[model samples]
Every structure is written in structure tokens, then in C-alpha cells.
Target: MRKTTFLLPIIVIVVAGLMSALFIVDEREKALVLQFGRVVAVKEDPGLAFKIPLIQEVVRYDDRILSRDVEPLEVTPLDDRRLVVDAFARFRIADVTQFRQAVGVGGVATAENRLDSILRAETREVLGSVTSKDILSSDRAALMLRIRNSAIFEARGLGLEIIDVRLKATDLPKQNLEATFERMRAEREREATDERARGHEAAQRVRALADRTVVELVSEAQREAEIIRGEADALRNNIFAEAFGKDPEFFEFYRSLTSYQRALKGSNSSMVMNPDSEFFNYLRSPSGGRAVTPPAPLPQAQVDAAEGAALEAAEADAAAGTAASEAQEEAETDVNNYEVDQVEDAEDGVQN
Candidate 1:
């Protein structure tokens, strides 16, 4: 009965000891055995792991990818502008032995802290080298690549592989954002005002040129009109001279009748000339001869008719004057020829 009792306690203690030495390494974890606070063995594969129950302990580490979102860091740019940035990093323990030696059982937290410091330092270095505009534009990719390279260099001694380092958000500090927006607004307004001034100046130049063109066109039209009017007046005077030169006596008699019609139409005075006057000669005889007497008075309507008939008679008398002038010229020509013949006869008699 004492042997049974001792064996039963021994078996129970042996089972409890084995249970304490044996540990489960899940598919997502790796185990490291530390003997007397020194790393003696590392189990990278997932399965059961064994260790000395009282003298050794097993430290498990995650073998999967780990994500760590860092706290937002405030950094000053090269231009002295303050910005807050949030970032995240993905990493994994590529060398479990080295990780265990370096950080022990702290798993990803130690690597994450070291990585956060490196990321913050390198991010500020790269972002400080450029302006805020470059960070917000196409250069952001290049900036990220530089940051990744810097972080890789920094994390080389930590026995952790930095898979990726990404920036979550980059923003100006609240205190400075309003001032930046105001400056941008002022720049845009200045550009707009300059554009409007250029447009107004261009329009003014165009209007001035158009007004000058209108004046030139009007002056050109007036010059052409004057030239045409002067030509017309010259043509009219030439026609009048040509028609009057054909029969000067008849033209002068018709002009005299026109003058008498104009003068007698509005006259209130009576003439007191002698009956033998040359003016009365045409009224009495109606031909080129001495005047005899004035014609008898007639009714008013007949007087007007008689005046028209007298004008007609005056035109006939002018035609007779032309005939008389031609006859007088012929007589003068005969007298001259007779005088020349008499001179020739005297010369012939002297020769005889």
C-alpha cells in the first residue's frame, strides 16, 4: 500500500513535470529555449517543443507579418514649416535566432519601437529636403522610396526585415494652415488681376486702331466724291460752250428775251423812252429799221399772248440779223477784190 501510494504520487509529479517542459508552438509562432537566462535553442517550425522544466524556459515569437501604426510625429521642414505625419510599418522576423539574441522574448514590439524611431528620423530628413508642394505632388513616391532605403539601413542591426514603410497622412499644423491658404489666395488673386489688366490694354489698342481706320476710310471717301463732282462740273461747262459757239447771234437774242421776261414780270415802273429809240425799234417795226409808233393797247390776256408773239418775232429778227451780217461780209469782200483789180489795171497800163 505504501509502494502504491509513492508510485501514484511519482506518476502524478512526472506527468506535471512533463506537462511543464512540453510547450505547444502554434503554426503562426516560433519558440526559443533559454537556459539559465541564455538562449540555447530556437524552434522555428510549428509543433511541440521541449525544454528543461525548472532550468530552462520557452519564449514564443510570431513568425507572421506584423503591423505597427506609429504615433503621429510633428516635424519641421527645411523651410521651417511644422507638419504632423502619421506612418505605419510592416515587418517580420526573418532570423529567429538573431531576433531572439537581440530582443529576446519581446517579439515584434522591440523591433517596432526601433523601426518607428528610424522611420521618424529618415522621414523628417527626406521631407525636410523638399517643399510642402513636392511632398503633396508626384515626388511623394520618390520620397517614400528614399525613406524605405533609410529605414532598411537603420533596421539592419535589429535582426528585423522592414517589409514596407508607408505614410498614412501628412498635414500642416492647424496653426499654420490658415496662413498658407491666405497666401495662396492672394497669389491667385494677383494673377487674375494681371490677366484682366492685359485684356483691357489689348482691347484699348484694338479700339484705337479701329477708330484710326474709320477716319482714314471717311477721308478717302470724301476725296473720291470731290474728284467726281469737279469732273462733272467741268463736263457741263464744256457742253454749254460748245452749244453756244454754234450760233452766237441766236443765242444772244434768246438770252435777251429771257432777261426781258424776268425783268417785266415783276416791274412796277413804266418806261419814258422816245419812240425812235433802238429799244422801241424792235417793238414798232419788228425788224432792223427806224421806229414809227407803238402798238395799240390790248386786253390783259391778249397782252400776254402778244408778248409771247413779240418774243417769237424777236427770235425771227435775230435770224434776219444773221443773214444781213453775211450779206455785209460778202459786199466787203467784193469791194476789196475790185480795189485789187484796179491796182492791177493801172500797172498794166503803165507797162504798155
Candidate 2:
């Protein structure tokens, strides 16, 4: 019983010791065997792994693709433009032995820190040679490719294989953003001003064209009107000439009548002129300017009545003159007879 107890305890201890010495390596992990802080072996395959009990330690790392996010960093490009960049990377531990050697007991933390530093350095080197515009442009993919290559090259020392190096954001620094926005705003304003100026120029051109067209139209219309007026005046002149040629006297009479109408147009019109003036030729003779013989005598009955009235008026005048002479002779005789009678009376008296 004592032996069995001692053996059982010893076996239990042995099994425990063996269990402690042996380790499991997962396919998803990369393990390194370290003795006295030195990496002695690496296990990358999934299986049972062995280590010296109490003398060696096993450190495991995730072999799967890992991600590291770099903090936002300020970078000045060759153009002296500053930008804030946030980036991340995908990587894997490609060599556990090298990882163990490079980053002793710090394990994944140390490896990741060193890898992050290399990635950040590569990012700065590649990105600093270009302008911020290129970093933010479609060409960013090519720039990232360069950064990844550089990171991969440098990451070999840290046992890291870079899958990708990508920028999350490449933006103007906060202090520069306002200035950029202002510049952009000013540029837009200038563009708008230019557009308005162009519009005004175009409008002026249109107005000028319209005014020119209007002038041309008016000139053409005036020309047409003048043509029509001239044609009408020619026709009128021709008609006047034909009528005058046919009967000059009649034409003169008609012209005089039209002149009279115009001269006596209004109620307030008054004209003083010699009655025998040539202007009265039409009135003096119906043949206008031509002289004519006297008109034929009136009917015999009308002539006899006029002569009879004249004889009666002459006889009445003669009777009035004869009566006046008789009165005068009678008055003289009375006076002379009175004187003779008085003288005879005087002589008689003297003789007595």
C-alpha cells in the first residue's frame, strides 16, 4: 500500500510534469520555444509541441492576418502642404523564429509595435515625396502599393509580411482646412464673376445685333416708302401733264379753282387784291386767260321792258324841271307888275 501510494504520487507528478512540458500549437498560431530568453525553436503547424519543463517557455502568436491602425499623423509634402493622415495595415507573422529573435518576450505586442513603426516610416517616405493632392487622389492606390512594398521590405527584420498599407483618410490639417476652404471660396467667386462678365458681354453682343438689325429694318422700310412715294409722285405728275397737254385753258381754270379753294380755306380768310388782277382771269372770263366777244343780246321782251322803264324815268325828270322854271317866271312877273303900278300911282299924285 505504501509503495503503491508513493508510485501513484510519483506517476501523477511525472504526468503533470510531462503535461506541463508538452504544448499545443494551433494552425492559427505561431509559437516559439524560448529558453532563458532565447528563441530555440519555432512551431507553425498544428500539433503537440515539447519544451524543457521549467527551463523553456512557449510563446504563441496569431498567424492569421492581423490589422494595425496607425494613429493620425501630420506629414508635409514636397510642395510644403501639410496633411493629416490616418492609416492601417494588414500583416502576418511570416517567420516566427525571426519574430522571436527580433522581439524577445514582448511577443505580438513588440512585433506589432516595430511593424507599425516600419509601416509609418514607409508611409512617410512614400507620401512625403508627393503632394497632398496625389495622396488624396486616385493615385493613392499606387502610392499605397509603394508604401506596402517598402513596408514589406523593412518588415522582414520584424518577421512581418505586409498584406496591404492603406490610408483611411488623407485630409488637410485642421489649421489649413479653413484656409483651403477660403481659397476655394475665393476661386469660386472669381469664376462666378467671370461667368457673369461673360454673360454681360454676350448680352451686350445680342443687344448690339438687335439694334443693328432694327436699324437695317428701319432703313429698308424708309427706302421702300420713299420708292413708293416717288412712284406715286411720278404717276401724279404724268396725269397732271396729260390733262394740261389736252386743254391748257381748262387746266389753268382747274388749277385756279384749286388755288381759290386753298386760299379761301378757312372762315377767317380775307384777301385784298386788284379786281382786274390776272388772278381773277377765270372770274373775268370763263375762258380763263383768253378774251371773248360780248355775249349775245337778251330776248326782245326783256329789252323792251328795260327801255320802257328808262323812258318813264326821263319824262318824270323833265316835268320836274319845267315846273320849277314856271314858278320862277311867275314870281318875277308879279314883282315887276307891282313896281309899275306903284310908279303910275306916284306920277298921278305928282300931277294932282
**What's the lDDT for all of these models?**
0.70, 0.75
Tens digit per residue, CA lDDT, model 2, 1-352: 8899789989999999999999999979988888888888888889998998999998888989999998888888889998888999999888888877788778888887887778778888888999877887876789989989887878888888889888898888888889998898777666656655555565556555555555555555555555655555565565557646666666666688888888887884788989988887878776666854343444566455545545554554555455445544554555455545555554444344
Give the CA lDDT, 0 to 100, for residue 63 in model 1.
84
| Angstrom error at residue 140, model 2 | 4.6
Candidate 2: regions farther than 4 A off: 1-8, 133-137, 140-142, 152-154, 245-250, 265-352
Evaluated with lDDT, which candidate comes out highest? 2
What TM-score does candidate 1 get on C-alpha atoms?
A: 0.57
Error of 1 at 113 (Å): 3.0
Kindly report which residue pairs in candidate 1 clash with one another. Answer: none
What would the TM-scores of all predictions be?
0.57, 0.66
Per-residue lDDT tens digits for candidate 1, residues 63-178, read: 88888888898877666778898888888877777776676656677767777888888888988888777776655777788888888866777777888878889988888899
